[model samples]
Structures are given as structure tokens and as C-alpha cells.
Target: KVMGILPFSAPSCGLITKTDAERLCNALVYGGAYPPRCKKEMNGGSLELQFTDRSFKVYHECFGKCKGLFVPELYTSPNAACIQCMDCRLMYPTHKFVVHGHKAQENRTCHWGFDSANWRAYILLGQDYTEKEEKARLELFLDEIKEKFD
Candidate 1:
């Protein structure tokens, strides 16, 4: 099942551009970067998501204060004071979607986008699958997304 859906977008002047989106998708699918690593850091109790070119450092304190997954770039602006965080719910195995065989729950919107200056790709999280199975699933998903742009 899909634990999370991370949509990578390219926004220019606060608007998402198709060209940028396609470019981002291409670089992500073809780029020789290592697979994303999501794990807790040993030194700090923070969660780090090492994606293609950038890393998302989510501090432990932010987890409780900020709702959902916090991507600083997506929220904070140079002049903005309040950090707009995504709203997410803590789901268990007994959740409605999980119990009904749904891959992901509906109405859960969590996406990360960037301006033209920076390109980023977020990892898709899955649950209840073996490592091999999860890897195959991710590969298949990427192949399908690449096909859309091609």
C-alpha cells in the first residue's frame, strides 16, 4: 500500500510549468543519482530523505509541531514568517483504506514542488511489502511516469 505520495513539481513565478515538470521528470528518471535513502540519523533523531540532488532534513521536534511531512522549501519564503506545513493523518493498519485494499487513501494531499532554480524529487513510501517487492513497485511506477512524458 502507498504510505505517501510525493509529487515533484517545478513552479516558476509561483506557477507550475509543464516544461519544467517534464524536465524534472526526465532528469529524475535518467539521472545516475543513487536511490533515495530515508532513515533516522544516528547523531540526531531527525529523519533525512536523501533524494536525487537534495536532501530533506526533518527534525524530530518538527514532526510534532509541523503536521505531515515538512519540506521547508515548499513552505517558507524569504519574507514569510509562518511555516505552512502539510496536513497529514497518522494511519494504522486498521485504517479504512488499508482495510479496504486501497493502495492509498483519498483526499490526502501531500506534494513537494520547487522553482526553476532548484530541482527536487521526493520518495514514495510504501508499507507491508518486502524490500524486493518494494523496489520492483517503485521501478514500475517510475517507468510509467517516464512513459507519460515521452
Candidate 2:
């Protein structure tokens, strides 16, 4: 599952342009001089975004009844790849799709886009750390191994 779904303000309806995709990616990834890897794919009526490091596959509604609606209120099913988000449940009372990864000792890592209104980041022993933690750890690790370029 991808992070939180941000509402598209433009009148193009639910359609996302290339520029919008890039901007959103940078905002989510947060790189000072270099941004993370993001690939936008137009799959039928949905816009799919794949982020490299985060291992997220985000799907957005580009057409149909959910047009102009980001996230589009999910419905629960018995699918193996679905897990309801605790943070998003207060705002959206529905189950969300989830994907599991083999890395990190085969833990169930979930992604959530951080919206100021839905900012509830938590870190469990088996769960992914909050963005703040990730950023801090990343900076420390990078500093240890980074090459000085003059």
C-alpha cells in the first residue's frame, strides 16, 4: 500500500500530470539535492506510482465515479494483500490494500502518506519507523559513509 492520498486541487478532475507526479514524489521522499526514484504508470483508469526505496505502489483514481477523489474510500474484502490502516480509519472508515516485503526479516511494512490532519506516526519493534526516525537514521548513516566531494 502507498502512503496517504492527497486530494488533487486542479480542475483536471482526478487526472495527474507528469509534473504533479514528480512534485508529489519529491514531497514524499524529501531529498535536498536529489530525489528518490519514482515512476508513474498510467494503467487504464488508474494512475500507479512506484517508489524505489519505500517499496510502495500507489494507485490513484483517474476516472469513473471516483474521479477527482484521491484515495476513493476503500472497501474490505478477503484478499491476502489487504490490511486496514489504523491511522487512516478515523478519516476513512474502510480497509486498505497492503503489500508485504521480504526484506527487514520478512515484516509486514505498510506505507501511509503523512497529511498534517492525519499525522499519527508510530514505531513498533516489527513495524516500520516513522518518517522522522527514518530521516534521522538515514542522515546519520549517510554521514558515516558519504564521500567528501570538493
Candidate 3:
């Protein structure tokens, strides 16, 4: 897989562009830097014979030019007297959760981005997972991303 996220510095953040976040996500969820997936079948059947549940697990392999810095919002409210930044997108507060994969322990999840307008991202958080599982699931997701994005 070729490296796709051309690294460049972000003037304001004094780091790299935020697109790197998506790129790392894309790679971890896809195969190559472009998120390519190679599907394998375990179901016992052939195309000429029949087709059953196509359901399967997903993975997002790791592949990126470099590690992307996380832009965790800080220092201000997204919905202040003069709303600005992404946190102000959704005025209503909500709680979105992250979930684990086929194997996950109950009551295990991470929460972030509170009191911000980007609550949709928080509210839309799907599923739950452990730190180790998140890494594994992320690789699987990257594979899926490759299938769609590539």
C-alpha cells in the first residue's frame, strides 16, 4: 500500500492538518492508504451453488505516512455568547457512545466532547469497546472503509 496522507504543517495548530485524522482512520479502517479491502469467505458455498448470509466481520488495517495528532477541543465552549467552531453545530446536548465489536465487556466505553456543539459526533457514537478491542475493531473498520472509499 502506498502512503497517501502527504504530511504538511498546520499553521494555527502548530502541527499537521486535521485531514490526517481521517487519513489514519481511513487506513486503520481500510487496507492501503486508500482503504482497500480484501474480502474472505468462510461460508461453505459457491456462486453457482447458492448464497446465504453474507454477514461478516470488518477490519481496518493500519497504514499511514505518519501518526495524526488528535485535535481534542479545549479552552472554550462551542456554544458561548458568540458561538464559533464545530461545537456550536448542535445546541442541544446529547450523549453518544462508542461500542465494542462481537466481543465486548459490558459498561466499557469512552466519552468525550461534552458541552460542545459537535454533540452530534458524541450523540452518534455507536457501539462500545475496550482500548485493545477498539484498536482491533478500528483495523477491521479500515478494511470496510477501503471497500467503500477506494
Q: State which candidate has the highest TM-score.
A: 1
Each model's number of backbone clashes? 0, 3, 28
Model 2 TM-score, all chains together: 0.16
lDDT of each: 0.27, 0.25, 0.25
lDDT of 1 by residue, 1-150 (tens): 122222333223465444334333433442221112423333554333322221121211110122222222322232221111122221111111111112232222322342222211222223323579755765565344324322
lDDT of 3: 0.25
> TM-scores of all models?
0.19, 0.16, 0.18
Query: lDDT per residue, candidate 2, 1-150, as tens digits?
Result: 133223434444566544344334533542211111312332453322212242211222111101111121121222112112222211121111111111122112123352311211211112233588765664453333222120
lDDT of 3 by residue, 25-57 (tens): 433542211101212342442111111232112
TM-score of 3: 0.18
Error of 1 at 1 (Å): 36
In model 1, residue pairs whose N, Cα or C atoms come closer than 3 Å (at least 3 residues apart or on different chains), thus clashing, are none
User: Runs in model 2 with CA error above 4 Å?
Assistant: 1-41, 54-133, 138-150
The RMSD of every model to the true structure, in order and in angstroms, is 19.0, 18.0, 20.2
